[model samples]
Target: MPVRLPGPAVTEELDRVLGDRAAPGYADLRRLPYLEMVLKESLRLYPPGPYGARETAEPLAVGEYRIPAGTVVFYPFRAIQLNPDHWPEPERFRPERFTPEQVAGRARLAWVPFGLGPRSCEGAGPAMVECRLLLAVLLKRFRFRPVPGHRVDATERFVRWAADDIRMVVTPRKAGPPPRS
Candidate 1:
C-alpha cells in the first residue's frame, strides 16, 4: 500500500482508528472501513483463484444467448473483474469502487475474487477477515515499498501468484500518539 496513492491515507486511517492501541484487535477490524476497501480493490486486481467452473442446474439465458441445462460454465474472475463495463478504469487501484454506495450500485457477481454461490470457497469469510486484520496491524507498524526494478506479475496457473514473488522493502514506523491514559 505504501506504493499506491491510498497508502498514506490508509496509514492515516489506521492511526485514527487504532489510536494508542499499539495494534488492532478483532473488534477494531470493523471500525476500519478504508482498509477493507483497499483489500477489495487488491483482490479485484489479483484474485488468487483466477477462475471457477459450475454446472448449470437449469437452462439459462443471458442477453441473446442461451445455454442448455447441465452445461459447464466457466467464470473467469480475473477477466470479469477487469471488464471495463462493470468496473470503470478497471486496471486502476481505486478503493472507492468498493464503498457501500458503489458496491450496491454494481452487479452482484461483478466482483467475485473468491468465487460465489453454494459451492463458493468456504474459507472466503475467514480469509477476508484475516487479510483485513493483517493489513491493519502491518500498516500501523510499517511502511512497505516495492524494491526498485522488481516487477510483480501474476501468472495464470491453478492459483495465481507472482512468478518470482513480490519483493518489497519494509521499514518500521515511528511511534504514533502515545498510549492514552
Candidate 2:
C-alpha cells in the first residue's frame, strides 16, 4: 500500500529538530524522548487538520443544544488542545506533558492530533519511528544551536508549524580527539 507522507513543511521542521540524528531503524530511534515531545507539541497545536467531523447515529444533548440523529458533529482539535481546562499552561512548549504517564491520565478524547476512532491517521506509527530514529542519530553525532537571526514562530497549515521556519546551525561532535590547527 502507498504510504501517506508527512507534509513537506512538517518534515523540514522535524529535520531541524532532529538535526544529525536520523537513524536506520526503530530500535535506534526509541531512545529519544525529547524528539517525541517536540512532535507531540506540534500535533497538539496544529493537528493535521483544523477540525474533525462525524455523523451522529443517534440524537444526543451536547451542552445546551440537542444534537439530532444524523447531525454532523464537529470536534475542533486545535481549540481543544489549547483549551486551558484540559491542559494547564497550554501555551508553553513542554515535552514532559506527553510522557507516557501524563498522556495516559489525560482525557481520552483530548489531544487528537491524529484524530480519533478507527479511521485516524494510519501513518502515525511509522512517522513516529522515523522521527525517533532521526533524533537518535542526530543527538549522537552533532550539537544544534539556533542560528543568530532565527527564531521559531509557530503557525497553522493543516498542522502547526514554525511561522518563520526553523533555522539552525549543526556542528559536528569531536569525541576523543583534540583538533590540531
Candidate 3:
C-alpha cells in the first residue's frame, strides 16, 4: 500500500483514529470506516481465494441463456471485483470506491471477497474485524515501504498470493508505547 498515494492517507487515518493509544478498543475501531475501505479495496484487488463455486438450487437465467438447476457455477472473486461495468477503473486500488455511498450504489454482489450465499465462509465476519484491528495496530506502530525492484506476480491458485513473494521494509514508529500484543 505504501506504493500508492492513498497508502499514506490510510496510515494517516489510522493515526488520527488511534490518537496516542497503542491499543484501541472496539469503540475506537468503530470510528475507522476508512480503514475498512482500505481492507475492502485490498480484498477487491487480491481476494483470499481465487475462485468459488455454488450449485444452483433453481434454474437461473443469464442475459440470453438459461442455466438448468443443479448446475454448479464457478465464479472468480477477483474477476467480479474487477469487472469494468461495476468498477470504474478495474486495475487501480482506490479505497474511495468502497465508501458507504459508493457501496450503496453498486450491486449487492459486486463485492464478495469472502464469497457469498449460504455456502459462504462462516468466519467472514470475525475475519474482517480481526483484520481491521490487526492492520490498525500494526500500521499505527510501523511504516511499511515496499522493497525496491521487487516484482510481485499474482498466483491464481486456491488462495491468492504473490508468486515471487511480497517483500517490504518495516520501520518502527517512535510515537507512543509499542502496540499491544
Q: How many residue pairs clash in all the candidates, one count each? A: 0, 7, 0
Model 1 spans > 4 angstroms off: 1-6, 63-65, 178-181
Per-residue accuracy of model 2 over 1-181 as CA lDDT, tens digit each:
1111123333343344444444435543444455677677756755667777789889999899898899988888878898888789887656567888988888977888777888788998877677566655665466666777665665656665566667777788433332233
Q: State TM-scores per candidate.
A: 0.89, 0.67, 0.88
User: Highest lDDT, which number?
Assistant: 1
Is 1 or 2 the stronger prediction by lDDT? 1
Q: Model 2 TM-score?
A: 0.67
- Model 2 stretches with alpha carbons more than 4 Å out: 1-24, 142-164, 173-181
- Order of quality (TM-score): 1, 3, 2
lDDT of predicted model 3: 0.82
lDDT of 3 by residue, 1-181 (tens): 2243246676666667677887668777788888889888888887999999998889999889899999999999988999999999888988999887999999999889989988899999999999988988888888777789777777777788778778888899755432453
Clashing pairs in 3: none
